[model samples]
Target: MSQNNDNSVLFGNGDELPSNASDNPHINQLIDGVGRRQVLAAGAALGTLAFLGSVMPGAAVAAEPAAKGLEKLHFRPRSKLPFTAIATNRLDSISVPTGYRATPFIPWGTPITGNYPAYLSDGSNSAQDQAEQLGMHHDGMHFFPIDAQRGGKKSDHGLLVLNHEYIDAPLLHPNGPTLVAGKRSSAEEVRKEINAHGVSVVEVRRGLNGEWAVLPSARNRRITGATPMQISGPARGHALLKTRYSPKGTATRGTLNNCSHGFTPWGTYLTCEENWAGYFASRDTDLPRELSRYGLRSSSRYGWDHLKGDEFERFDATRTTTTASADYRNEPNHFGWIVEIDPFAPESVPVKRTALGRFAHEGLVFAPVKSGRPVVCYSGDDSQNEYIYKYVSRDKYRPGRSNGRLLDEGTLYVARFDASGKGEWLALDIYDKKFQQACKAAGVSFADQGEVLINTRLAADVVGATKMDRPEWGAVNPDNGEVYFTLTNNSARTSVDAANPRPANAFGHIIRWRELCKDYAGRQFAWSLFMLAGPEADSIGPNGKPLTADNRLASPDGLWFDEEGRLWIQTDMSGSQLSSGPFGNNQMLVAEPRTGELKRFLVGPVGAEVTGITATPDFRTLFVNIQHPGEGSTATNLLSTWPDGPGQRPRSATVIITREDGRRLL
Candidate 1:
């Protein structure tokens, strides 16, 4: 589910066996300060840290309260979630609670714009046609309600924008991918795959019969790998991003492997780029330091570079000529940033906002906004032993006045888990004294702020940020703005810390924290584990049992909080959990934050990962994505027959869940 969501991000690398990620000795390179910090956090880190940490996100540090910080947190409780718990099953169909019904909507190949050709579903759609339709492997999404007009907050009808993270080639084409001698056979196949990797925004409206349907509207648009993007923030004009196509180093084409998402206070879609490095190939006898750290290799994960033509050549970053624009060597640098797209202004070029400090970003969540206060966003670099990050905007956020401008300038910080239950946000800024000293010792000097951003992972290391166990999706509680993240397991960890209590953590746990007294942007915060996920049988010891009425889910990936203050978690079972574990299939569950009561809400079909959740503003209609059904299937030996009968193609789809009586969900 969320396991293979993105190739694990690495400050250093070692992966579960059979994975293509290369092992690197960089793990030993971590500054003693950070490693010792993690071990300390593991032991004493239990409740809110009893020290100075963060300043309020909106308030100045000097204005911080003199009293207890996070201990002062008092979140209001909401009503318990509705619906009976669903049991995990190996069945080949979407299962919902007893009173609910599910229906597929705007799945891959569905046309969102009027001029796009209707999906033939027979794999006959051309590259251009697929470009105009929804991309493949639906992931994280959000429903922006059109309140009668663009900035309006109308709940019943709105634009449903979702991410297509990856594609299922065999099902996308007539039979399977065309190959000649193990290389691509047609340029169109490569183009179609490219078109299938991006974001889609489509209008949906409730009919007179009270059913939701895709409505052709001007706002409906598709942003595929072909969409041109503008690079902004500190890393905009860096040499690492310079290419012949955008010599100024400010623009590039398309986005790749958009896994999770976020919504800004200004009404724009924040599409996160995960695992973009795998798309390019570099045959260099030696690799660029940053490129190598991100996992760019001599061969691509999918051999798109092997296709024959200049159109397909961009997929290969290997330097072919001596000149600057001759190849795509700098192409990979343009990716891996948090891309901002204005769904309302469909024609606007999406921007890759660099202030966020990119990594294999899984998902992003913003803290509650206040006028005259700086905005704060939390993101997880979904990789094994990578770090969690945050960005504090330079300017105060004005509700209606701020759209995308608030993202242009900010300070990026990596988290350090203090063993005492408290944590610190280590500034990765080039000017940070300790970080500067670390870089100096390594014989490096900051050429500019851009250099710090281009090599964000290295900067985090120099500053000593704590390594985590594959941090996935994160959420800011609506009830109190408490930040919560899913550390989705790390079997590669030969050692364990208090933050990661389990040895070779196969099943992950949910960690949450309170920003100092009302200071959502404050550097210091108090944190605690909300739930430790594992099979019910393994819920023994001080690790405590899975939450009462446990779901026993693994790799918690996608997470969202409904208007009712209910937190919904989506599970991702990678490798063995797909079949060998008691977690029968990927699932989605509902949790009561105040009580830690979790219930299994729905389970996906065989080989399908249940992800990308969003409910309409009214909370009556809920949407969930079924990704890679029959995934890892071969042309001759398929793994599943889901959403379709036996022998038919299994397409990843978005399905809507609603109560039979049309009452509110949760």
Candidate 2:
């Protein structure tokens, strides 16, 4: 998972909840019934679940519901396993239900061209070889079926689009690149790194015996940072995006820091750009004015500025000269937007849809479309105390078949949570009075819609939207028409408020809302706290309110709902305090939304983030990505010996999880 923005501050210090409590009746009602009761029962249940040593890990067994609303597990022996027990010492094995098995499908740098040799991990691969091989740091992913006639067949194959985030330079380059007095050792080295940072589309199929493998077809394609992409929607051709490669400011050459993703209803891959800000650096003295606009407070931590070339120099947004044409002021503007790719059409140019307001986009979930009505999209800003936003396409989604052009136009709105439990979707338009006033106050002039979309964060702040704890992935419950977003933990969120009132939010919570009259494009909605993270003891009702064990989870990150309406929740935690101490490591949990029944399904090893979950229609097989294991440790002195072996270092890989009995995960 990606870190939130830098502006957020902790609400209160220590573990205690904030003292300035709300007098609202709804808060009191929640505290009285559901909150208090659930906490108590969850506390007792956690103790029992942790202490029940008889239930061996991976055994399928149903768990007795300590509270109502939570359904009993169908597999008694398997469901009883504690959430923490899923972590394993084995390098290439998955800890799943007893009957299940996990196969490592595509490891980092796997050959895709059928010509490149397997990854040796010694940094000897060439730029061409790396391009033909799988990119490093695999994050959000989705599996698309090639044949609709197969009826969700596991035996059928499809295309897999996986985001290749930043590369491990130290691991990828031999003896590390030799910086010649702050310049890159060679231009080829820069080329290699750029070519290694994007998305990979590989053809995959299942064998007759039900085994899944990559199909080395001619359609296999690798899109890297050098790949040309078009700018679309409101921000296309904006002056802010002007670059030598894209002099018209309507096109750019890549996506970086791709994180959690979403699949479009029209069958396109949505790859979010996270932590792209760290790739560039602007000198404090050289371009002070330009640096401020692009959010570059100082030189970047990654030090791409020292590369001494236009390709590397574009990362530096600082402008030494007064004119934008003379410097790279517009470079940063080209990035930080949701990039869409049609994996099926390898030749199609990827598009950066500006209709979706730009920021640190984490994920984009689409609501089921209604003909003649606008299509809705939910996205999280992925920063501490940042905001959650939605976009409603002006064009209606035509039924029967996808036209693929509907996404080109839309109105993006940021969310505002009111104390009355109502929420509003604030439109982000340059012409809006709120936005105009804000721009005037900031002493900035916008030429058109493009500027507003490019500078969306500033526009949203002017409207006073509710800030949340690093909102990440979002999922819509088809059964209830409720939208659920993961409020990944915020070290800065210390005090309670109407939206996020809790102090010291170690384990974050989930916020769910029902659109007015089930209209995805509606601006008004009713909202409620769906689940609270922390120890089970902390999430309970005061008196008669209903509660369930499923509500108690920590730092909710990746979220998805299977076809059966089973909600899968994944956790992401950082800092030694959260990762090592009381909270073990990140894990994946499963929940049934209607019943409010949730259970710990699986967990990742130390230093790994549980992310990118997708399932076949049958739910018999699942795919999850383990990202950046042992990431926090220094390369010289590692903290975790994961995927263990001599000379073995943590590498992000996708795990294929399936039930041993070939049963569904629910």
TM-score of each: 0.89, 0.83
Give the poorly placed runs of model 1, Cα more than 4 Å off.
1-78, 148-152, 540-544, 547-550, 634-638
Cα error, candidate 2, residue 607 (Å): 1.0
lDDT of 2: 0.66
lDDT score for candidate 1 against the true structure: 0.73
Tens digit of per-residue lDDT, candidate 1, span 1-666: 344533332111112122213222222132222332222222121222111122222222211222245333344555666567887788888889988989887777888885778887568889899988888889889888876235655767888999988776776777767877767777888899889999999889987666888887898999988789999988888877888688878888999889899989888899998877777778888977677767776666567888776567777887777864667788888878889988888889999999898688888899877799899899988777788899999899986688677787888988877655567888878777777787787676678778888888777766667777788899876655667898877766666554665557788777776676454677887665566677766542112333333467887777888765678888878679878867888889887654445688988888887888887767788889989887776555668766656876677889989888888765
* lDDT of every predicted structure (CA atoms): 0.73, 0.66
Predicted model with the maximum lDDT: 1
- The residue-by-residue lDDT of candidate 2 on 1-666, one tens digit each, is 634333222111011121112122221222222222222232223221111122212111112221122222232223322233233222323455455677666877788864856776666778888888888778788888775324435435778788986765655566555566655557677777877788888888767677888777876888887788999887787777777667778888789878888887767788998656666665646543223433554555445566676777777776667766667767777778899898777779999988887788888898877677778888988766567899888778766565546666777888887655566888887767876775677576767888778877766766667777778889986554567898877665435554464655666777766666445787887665556677646652211123234334467888988765567888777665344544566677776544445666666666677788887656667888877666544445555545544556556778888766666655
Clashes of 1: 20
TM-score, prediction 2? 0.83
Q: What is residue 582's positional error in candidate 1, in angstroms?
A: 1.3
Candidate 2 runs further than 4 Å off: 2-93, 148-155, 175-186, 284-294, 320-323, 400-404, 433-445, 540-553, 577-579, 633-644
